[model samples]
Target: MLKREVETAYDDPPAAETVNPQGASPYMLLCEHASNYIPTRYSGLGLDAKELQRHIAWDIGVAPIARELSRRLDAPLVLSGYSRLLIDCNRPTGVASSIPEISETTAIPGNQTLSHEERAYREAAFYWPFQREVGRILDQRQAKGTPTIVFGVHSFTPVFKGFVRPWHAGILFRKAERLGHALVDALQEPGLTVAANEPYQIRDESDYTVPVHGEARGLDAVLIEIRQDLIGDRDGQMAWVERLVPALQTVAAGALARA
Candidate 1:
């Protein structure tokens, strides 16, 4: 293997960046598909500029919202800096989607064949630093006996496989029912659409953020997914943020009380 076949440096932008690491709120946020940046060595993963901009590359318009939420909610947020094509921060290590060869319908040529060292390099450089930061934050909260509600912010394309999704947003949870249901109900207003566990669900086998950092520690964890089309621009991102900030603030007390 050539010396440049795999990741060897931190690059210009690190694999992950954290905001408000010492935030006071119990709400800890994670944006796994926050960026679509592919290191120069990957060479766009054999993709054109257009495909790299697609949802398969990253969760469109989520990083900004998560950043704002970290501010408005006074919560600490962990954002992965690289593209999901390199390795998905939210996914468990070695899963199919973690380093997807085919995301949605588009094939990732650079990911087609990877060696043990290459895979290991990506995990060390792209994955662990993010997950460990999350774990460290959670551990601090646990030791301090501080209340915590783990939330992962994500986005999905409005259409997949020729089917259109109806809900504008979905709150996914496995054990944090009280907090998750409260959010789903709150987002349900006169004209808005919200559901429980739509788009995706949390599975220990596939998911890492909530399952390991939240649930494993007995903390209430939930995954909040918004429609990518709804948050594709600045205005759309703010609207959803205005909607979610209040909902999260409202249910937080009850969730923490239960915990």
Candidate 2:
């Protein structure tokens, strides 16, 4: 099984040039829950067709939107290829929440109890590389004397349990940065309620991106979450790309200006 050929289970190395290169400045964008692919290696983890489609597997619409946004903004994007069920790429390998057995009401069969070796295998194969790559990108950019502002892009399900998340978009940040706050202000859509880390808060125990890349390095970073329904389709994705480009561009510019 170690050498198994599963397309969705493994992540291909990023291209020599970043997939999406945006702006002349050093700001980078990332979408950790960007893909739903299961790397055919796991055979859907003994799940039914419907089970694989749940939010437990991936954050719907995030990959494509992130790709489009990267292309539109010319920003480098480090996206994960495996489903979160295999092992959440954004989480630390030792964290229980890294590979959740129960996500909302859905049960992930492949994630049931197993040997310590099994856990370590998933961590080594999928989780570490994804994170290390992000770290490497940041390091290289910083070494060039470029200020890095990491943007974490993710999408959430519209209806969870019974209650609905009302905000169209929301921003999560542990430390206040001038650029992040300005982005929230610029993204004030008429019907959209932009939450400043509502629904969830950023803490060291659970968050991987902020602690590892942002807070640890003292670089400006903001975790941006968009409701999945909005970007679930091609048209909606384009609309979001357009809506967010100027604001992100302005925010990127603001980061440069601050330095």
Candidate 3:
């Protein structure tokens, strides 16, 4: 029998949801902060429902966008099923953000004290499964001689720490500068700003997906962040979808071809 979590989260749904695993597109998408669902046992990590709904708990509105991108691009997508507060799927375990005590302006009451067992349990229950699946899929693709580039879809609050972010979208990369700048250029439009590595930067200490899953294997990778306000509703999501698909298509072809 598997080593059960001291506190079981759910029975039916698995930790990671994989869509279109055999998708033909060279791009692979990830939405690590996809859900804001903290198990009832955690009591929303000692937060009320309203606070749980904030960006501190999740990426706000990029999950559906990623799913749609998967369908439109015929690209495989992996989504984490739990809130980042429960355990951040994109953060390396044992880091402060792995189970952040304070997310932005609000302090997470439940995370203030944690036993090693609890931390380990959360990682085992929530984090590793998603990571393993990502690794497995990439391994399979590599064996099949497929050219795969990774994109992490995320959304950030338009105003963070009281300062308004000017860029409409950010393409963050560590080693894939060529592809990153190309994507920024692709998404640029009149009265629209697409930035390269603005708002947030990808560092091994701060992130896992692009650094571990993408750069580690020498794959071209980027984390795409859209201002949360832009993708808050169906119309907004579709608009971004329309804007992103073509740019990704154009950039991925050239990025992979050059590699």
C-alpha RMSD for every candidate: 2.3, 3.1, 1.4
Model 1 segments more than 4 A misplaced: 1-11
Indicate the TM-score of model 1.
0.95
lDDT tens readout by residue for model 1, 135-201: 8888888888888889999999899988899888899999888788998987888878898999777
Model 3 residue runs over 4 Å out of place are 6-12
Among the numbered candidates, top lDDT falls to 3
lDDT of 3 by residue, 1-259 (tens): 2366545644635789999999989998999999988777777788998998889999988998999999999999999989999899999999998899999988999998899878888888889999999998899999999999989999988898899899889999989999999999999999998889988999999999999999999998899999999999999999999999999999988977787
lDDT per residue (tens digit) for residues 57-159 in model 2: 8888777777777777767888886678878866766777788877788777777885677787777667777787788888877777777788888887788
Model 3 clash pairs are none
List pairs with backbone clashes in candidate 1. none
In angstroms, what RMSD does candidate 2 have relative to the true structure?
A: 3.1
- Number of clashes in model 1? 0
Quick one: ranking by lDDT, best first? 3, 1, 2
TM-scores of all candidate predictions against the true structure: 0.95, 0.89, 0.97
